[model samples]
Target: MISRLITILQESELLLSDQEIESFSEVQPLLNDEDIADALWLASKIGSAYKVSEPAAIKAVSESDDAIAIEVIDDNTVVVAPSPMVSAYMPPAAKSDNGSMETPELGLPIQVQAAPALAHPREISRSLRPLLRKVPSLTRSELDESATVNRIAERGIWLPILKPSPERWFDLELVIEASKFSFIWQETLDEFQQLLEGQGAFRNVRTWTVKEAATGQPQLVAKRQQGTGIEQDQPLRSPKELVDASGRRLVLFLSDCRSRLWQQGQIHDWLTLWSQHGPAAIVQLLPERLWSQSELDVGFAVQVGSLMPGAPNSKLQIRELPARTEIAPADTLTVPLVTLTAEALKQWALVVAAAGRQRSPARLFDLSWVSDPERDQAMAVIQPQSAKERVELFMATASLLAQRLACMMAAVPVELPVVHLIQQELLPEVQSVHIAEVYTSSLLEEVRPNRGRL
Candidate 1:
């Protein structure tokens, strides 16, 4: 019976390798009914597995001069199978739910368990199956197959920064981590130099000048040495000489500690100082973060000269003073230099308002819609009139569009009409309609000409 089975396998061109056949011969005496059934099952499985790998195997085996074919009959007769002049091709089998074939038991006087291994059938099929029959030895391509499968299953590449291009008229400086002073110092100096060099009313402007503000006899020749920088010194020459050398501008002096303290009340005192003592058209460029802090109290000092009745001399007195204006910083601070244009400011304000609206429960729709189409559709449904309301509507529509797009891209089935309804028809109508009552009414009529269609 064993020889008949072996001959049948060989005739069908489902023969095992020489080594496998030898191993089977040694174990043939241990076979039982269950072992026979398992062997038959394995043969059937090998047939199915070959379908996937047959093309490669055939190409390999057909190249060998020793390749042979065999056939089997239902009556258990064995015969030589025919070989095609050119290799024949077969389509891979459709995947099936049948578990992998179990190995036959050695025909020893031992109890056998019929249960399959704990591993999945697909895994077992891949591990043990051969691609072609009556062709030399079968080689497992498990690793290569697994790698191909994994490559096919992978998703898109994720990057840390998605937006690589900078927006128009906007400059972005990103620093992972650094001290604030070190970061700002070079950038600020460069910007200031550029502005000075550029053609403008303030081009080649000077910030510092020294002149005697008092007149008096040389009662006590008190010499005071000052820092050598342009803005740090007080003039030693006579009042007329000083005026001729520099300009008739009042001087102010503050310690480095005082300057740092004044920065605490940045926006208010800085603006005030510029308005009062500095040039009428001057602007103070300070750190954006420093200007944002609202707690600091600031003070300034102005120098005035008292003329003496006696000789060609003066008494310069430095008087402490208060600021002329004050303002608190908003949550979103806008740098006047970068976003100075009216249109840019307006757009920025809208964006900030939209961001705020997204945080509110009542404005949940704003967070839902992101894409322009969906936002327009949602707006069509819930038409907003005011600028603030429109921003809220756009945000809600954007959120909804994002959610729908994500669902679609993920291959998770979703209702098509719902996606279209929110993104297409509704959002466009809302975005197009003007805010005026008459205009809005006409627009609505034009958008929904067939009221029953929606």
Candidate 2:
């Protein structure tokens, strides 16, 4: 029944956060689906009975961009976001014997539980900043002739402190996943989405949700108001449509990876396509401990050779390699699974920023996931390690543009634009020493497909 309810939320386009999902998972058994839905909708909003002790705190938290996703409710308060989208789809509640509407009582009451872990998912979502903000941020500095001449004439200085023309980058696309029938869990989720947009450090954040369609295919959805004056779902976009060929867009998919569509491999195909074209990663909706239970661990976890804000390697080699005797190479795609925690996002920023660059041992997402039921949640294919190790594992798989820049400079067939891309895009590029080492290694192979560029 709980599983069925989860399915409802996913199908209804109500995005719930990890904490909310956990709350529902532990809910006491419901008499039926309608009761669960009514209980959830009314519990957070039952007049004074459901009101918080600190209404000002609620207002302040709602107004605060930083405080949005964190846990603010006490034992007495059941704070759920009211979603017309949820109410529209949920079954109507049954009335009592007297024909008066029966009030639904919540199955989940606040209780003492295990101590909070070091990493809180809600707090992490509110605070995690993207380390790699834009991909290949291109720019050119032009001399400000008027200012420069004036300065030279007035103060006898030659520095232009040039005016830079940066390329208009793509917006950050935040994708979230909900289950089949979990409309009741949308409260904290709306706040979580707002947090990502408000505090995620991206200039523009476009959130698109992934949900299981009635046909059982997972789809990309947008909300639109119809001519009749009611909000309705727009036509679904195929997951492949999310790809940006310029490798500019930074795509973040937030999911617990428990949807049937996820386990069915439909989600995996598009994720591969997204990573290949540009920077993309799953902002894991599950806590770290339960990663093995989901589809996150299907890939072999080899340490990558290199990453960004760091020099690229010449023919990178993965270290401390785990032997995957049974895992086939063709089945793996290097899609990063990242938690919303600070350190994890830091590493993910580096790894994903380097997605889709040419490398020796293939590239990240080279070995895509083949979700196996036997292996599903049985054990994590990619185990938790230090952020450095995570980055190394990712880059060992192959760092993208960073390694490319190193290769270009190493071979000495450097284009001004490519160098500028690194210097401009990667503002704090790697040190001269690293570039010098690439030159010193004598490891780069020069290829001349066309003599003009060479």
Q: What is the C-alpha lDDT of each candidate?
A: 0.27, 0.52
lDDT of 2 by residue, 211-231 (tens): 777888787886433688564
Instruction: List the lowest-lDDT window of 10 residues for candidate 2.
Output: 358-367
Candidate 2 deviant stretches above 4 angstroms: 1-164, 167-170, 180-185, 223-231, 301-306, 309-321, 324-330, 350-454
Q: Clashes per prediction?
A: 39, 29
Best model number under lDDT: 2
TM-score result, candidate 1 = 0.16
